[model samples]
Target: MLIVITSEEFVEDEINIIKRLLKEGLTTLHVRKPFFSSEEMKRWLFNFHAEEHQQMMLHQHHFLAEDFQLKGIHLKEEHRKSIKGKEQDFLEKIKSQGWVLSTSFHELQEVENQTLFDYAFLSPVFTSISKHNYEGKKFSVQQNKRPVIALGGIKTENIEKAYQLGYQGVAVLGCVWHQENVITSFKNIKKEYKRVYQ
Candidate 1:
């Protein structure tokens, strides 16, 4: 459940770097290019192998996911609420197509409502480049019966703290994308995770 977020800012070579990382050991690759059009995502998916596509989850664009047969779809908190009362219906529809659902949660109440998806991202577990000054934020994992992943500013150094706090795993963005060496960064973080949890 080690999730790595893909960035639109990644250079062409960076895509290859990520592909290599995926081959090496990364578990989940979240295609979170908020700026990418559905056409662009489709093009990117077409370029990758089926194994890569199978491990990838789109950030939004449920229709595109269905069209491509992606593993699942993730929504931001705002997007999650827009379809609020119809969550069960929506989940059933997506589930029927063999797609899982995931969303973000900034509060305890959101985590408590576990009907939407298989997991929720409870973020800013540590100060992160993607989120600044997140230390003051509350990270309540007690309300979740389903798996809850810690996101936001997570890095290799603080992953143990995140797991101790009851997160299933950490979802990373800039820490991996903005690194000087993406593969090494991912391997280091992943190794630490395995060492600690093992």
Candidate 2:
């Protein structure tokens, strides 16, 4: 699987590029704008056709999942800790509704210990393209045993590397948004994902 993340700052014509990718068979999109309010997310997603809603996984304002019938809810560290008091109850609730659950991790050991998620993201497998001077962790994805998605500094050139290293999938941030031609860039990543894993 290949996943795409929204840039923290809006890029020009971002939604239209995303729409084109959906037509080209984009499956999962992680809407991770930490600055956006639920209303802002709703207003922005309103621009898309309703059929596309199932592909979106919101990183904030997860309640919007019910309103939009989105793919699922993604939790950060803070959100995950907040529900720790009633983790079982929360899990049951999401399961009853058939919502997908995902989270992010910076360390590979943490991923091995965690069993609550459908998939987890372990990032900085390479130096971050958008974050200044944040070096890569360089952990071997081949050692990972869970459904882990590699994030950070992933581009078409190195997508096959990620797969060979044993990642079930990859999530793109900088490679997709920072490019001059976003559609072509995403298409190339998708193409490479198929080449390596299919």
Q: lDDT of each prediction vs. the true structure?
A: 0.78, 0.87
TM-scores, each model vs. reference: 0.91, 0.96
lDDT of 2 by residue, 48-160 (tens): 87789899988999888888888899999999899988888999988987889999999878888878889999888888998998787766767666799989889888878
Lowest summed lDDT across 10 adjacent residues in model 1 is found at: 129-138
Model 1 residue 54 CA deviation in Å: 0.8
Please report the candidate that would top TM-score against the real structure.
Answer: 2
Pairs in clash, predicted candidate 1: 128-153
Clashing pairs in 2: none
What value does the lDDT take at residue 162 in candidate 1?
80
- What's the C-alpha lDDT at position 56 in model 1? 80
Please provide, for model 1 over 7-96, each residue's C-alpha lDDT reduced to its tens digit, 9 standing for 90 to 100.
767466866887898898876788887777878778777877777777888895668877777788898878776888887787788889
Task: Give the number of the best model, judged by lDDT.
Answer: 2
Clashes of each: 1, 0
lDDT of 2: 0.87
